[model samples]
Target: MPELEVSYKTTSKQFLGRVTTSKESADFIRGLFNEGEIELQEQFIVLYLNQANKIIGYYKHSKGSINATVADIRIVLGTALKCLATSIVVSHNHPSGNLHPSAADKVLTENLKQSAALMNIKLLDHVIITKDGQTSFADEGLLGIKTYDQHTAFVQKVTEALEQKTKHNKLSLEKLAQTFGITDKTEVKELTELAIIKTARILAHSAGNVKERFDKIVELYHAQVNLSHRTSQSILLQQYSTPAPIGYLAGIFCEVDKLKEKGGYAFEPSAGNGLLTIAGEPERFYVNELDNFRNQNLKTQGFANVWNRDATQAFFDVQGNFNAVITNPPFGTAEKKVMYDTYSIKPLEHVMALRALDCMAQDGKAAIIIGGHTNWDDKGRIQAGKNRIFFNYLYSRYHVCDVININGAKLYSRQGTSFDVRLILINGRKLKPEGAASLFNPLKDVEVKTFDELFNRVMDAMDAVTNNTFMKPTNTLEREAIELQKLFTTTELISRFDNPPPQEGLGEALNPPYQPACESSVVLNTQVPDSMAFETRTAIQSIKEAVGGDIDNFVRHRLKYPNK
Candidate 1:
């Protein structure tokens, strides 16, 4: 056991060494050089290990600055195989007496942690050696580790970038930082640079004035807005975040012709920019968004009916009837309630607290954006799979119509998310079990049995189910769709964990685990999914993995096709 423990420690040490040392180890090593006499520049070396602590051939392959070196993830670890090192140690010399790590040094170490994680290598320690003694990052509890401070900082940076996404409308960097609770001007400048390019791309596509930029920014910002009135003034300020692609709001005008056929009712429980309202859904629409900034913009745009109110309380406050309910509800939690970055780190109750209009008229048609995993349910505890099932169950009752799947993942490649948007159409009329109930049902022309038959099936079902019966027994179709939806809610995954990442995108974490799957194997151990149903799930997973939760990609792709 002692030998095993020692071996483990050695491997951990070597793994961390490679991470902090260099990302790649392709070139030959630089001779220990003298930088201004006392300043020694030593490359951070990764010691790859086998079973225990053992000597391995070093990848002396970095020739760069005086502080740190980068190695290719594959090459750095590959050295371990060649040297047959059971465990490795990372050692670096500080030419100067200063053993403290620089900001760059810390960042590189974290990036290495992320990479080592992907490679399944253990990160042990990062020792900063001076002429006198060695200072270990692991000993300091900094090896392959990051404090909550860094994570919040990262979220703030990303948030700043999202705010900048609307800067084309001329939102000053300083203003955005303050909204996010950053009082330091230095942080504002730092964050602007991070997202300026992406923001420019978004702005370049828009044709708007300075005021308009602020207006557009409100949508992005309000997505993360803190709505509580009793909250601290600091926390109450609107938290600007990145607005997803406008493609995310596709089909806002969908079934408009049909919606007009009935006495019109339009409601947006969480209207950000009143995107749906502006798209011309209802003549006198009612919008309930907590962010005053956005609501004011809507009111300025002649949406006087808009109000700054909590959406969850819509049931109690709004007494008006509705013909259509359209919105892209914040698919995740509200900023004031819980903290989240790109992906939800932990399963917080806030996720369940933010459901779309449960009060939609049974016969009203509704559109809402949701995460791919929104349907889960943990024993009515609210999970993605279970939510979808419950949503289906709710719609199956009277007043709910068809649920339309909005394919939004095929376009955006930002994060790997299975989340997408869908439209749930309900009319005031109760849908019968057997009489062409599906047309009244919403999912038509949305989800697919096979990618090839996607739209055709939607149209045919809508066409064929015109005379459905309400009491028709649940059959194979309902069972199959419900089963797939359940996967999003039932299957468990790592809600949160920590690791370092590459400075450039796609950095790995030290031994960071893969996302838990409904049926997961490190290697593709299961037989290939060959059936149309299985293939459909596979296609969905492929799209989800490519973009995480951003749904604009799929929306853009589907829009390219002619209206079905």
Candidate 2:
């Protein structure tokens, strides 16, 4: 048997002109297409570029009827690999001449971008060319793909600056205590706050954008204040903060971006240092942390509202008010009693989940991270007994979307311990009365063992839930009663305890991090070239010559238009 030889062939050995702007790339691509065929059909093309953005070659991928064409990502990427191209730009023509991209276009571009990222190849742009003009995904900010190199460089710079600031602050605090013999805890706290404020200002000066600045500062503050110095109470409470990446994934599972765009309210019942709250990024953020220091930390992070109360009884005042909720509640048995309808005592995770569901507004969404043992047994089977009852109650009352078991070993390696953890994504719609009888678990049948698997599973779940609409159940009265009773117990618990007011002035310097800044100046010019019309005319002339100078008949015989 003979093996087939693989090789890339090109008519032109030298490269085309370098492409810096979207307009230049679009013009170059337009020339590659036959002007008559472009209006008559839909076609996908890929331009392979070197590190200097010089086009090595172009491949005509697929051609279809007037309405649509397939952009096979595998073929496109394989050709780039064969050419050793560092980046690629994909283009497709829309015969309809509509400048606005369709939803399908966005999905295809996202899929291609994600796949290209895995091979260390950059997707520079997805250009939509029309007879009249073109649209650039990168120029319109529709790509939604971050430049990893720039992001990593910025983060490294901030991390180094933070380390120096931490060391300097420690030295200054030590000198103050030694020289003045001022050891009162309150005074020492005030001094430490001032040091943090100065450090924040210094970091803020070097940030490239407002979003990056806020995210880094919140992350820095969480790392500096929460994990660097742990209190005895935090340990006793079993406070294991959710990693930032995990928190961000939970937010995606809940569709927090869409909720935030609608100016929705978000609540975190047990917001340790407010990492999950930061991930939620809703227009209005509310947080409750039982630990005094952490509760104060939330206030200092400038949340819209801060409460120092037990997770099970935290948000009684604002029941059914939150539009989004992302929480990582305590995992172990509760030292304090957590009572809900019919269940006097439950696992801390169970009660906390109920508390969050109780506070969600109608049609709201949530992502809750809980212990795997709460639902899965030692052998990974669905646990029976009390866990079944809890899940049954949830299924009867709410829309349980999915249960994804995240690999705990990789998720918590930074903490030097590993355990099973699962995330539950749910919506706030009440189920019909018949739903009570359907006591089935929504957990994934197979275990998720790697971080990539968990991420892909979460993204798939997010897309599925977002695209399909879950009907709002009509049994409002019964659902309302159940929620009211859940809150009523919390209200009773709250009445017996009085929480001190959160400290102020700790967030004064933190204001700059959250303030809006100027837009990034890296946008490529997308204006169509002035010579496009003339070039189109020239291309048409050439096409007419090839088709025996009968342009009208050529178009009439070949062109097909879609029904609007």
Task: Return the TM-score for each candidate structure.
Answer: 0.33, 0.44
- Indicate the residue-level lDDT of 503 in model 2: 34
* Tens digits of per-residue lDDT for model 1, 329-429: 44444343322222232322123222344445555555444444233233222244434434544444434334555444442212122345454434343
Cα RMSD, model 1: 29.0
How many clashing residue pairs are found in candidate 1? Answer: 94
**Candidate 2 residue-wise lDDT, 380-474, digit = tens:** 22466656666667766778666776676766533323667878878666644234312123334446776556667777666667776333333
Clashing pairs in 2: none
Q: What is the C-alpha lDDT of each candidate?
A: 0.42, 0.62
- Model 2 residue runs over 4 Å out of place are 1-231, 335-340, 343-345, 374-381, 433-443, 469-564
**What's the residue-level lDDT of 538 in candidate 1?**
46
Error of model 1, residue 507, in angstroms: 55
Cα RMSD to native, each candidate?
29.0, 35.1
Model 1: lDDT equals 0.42
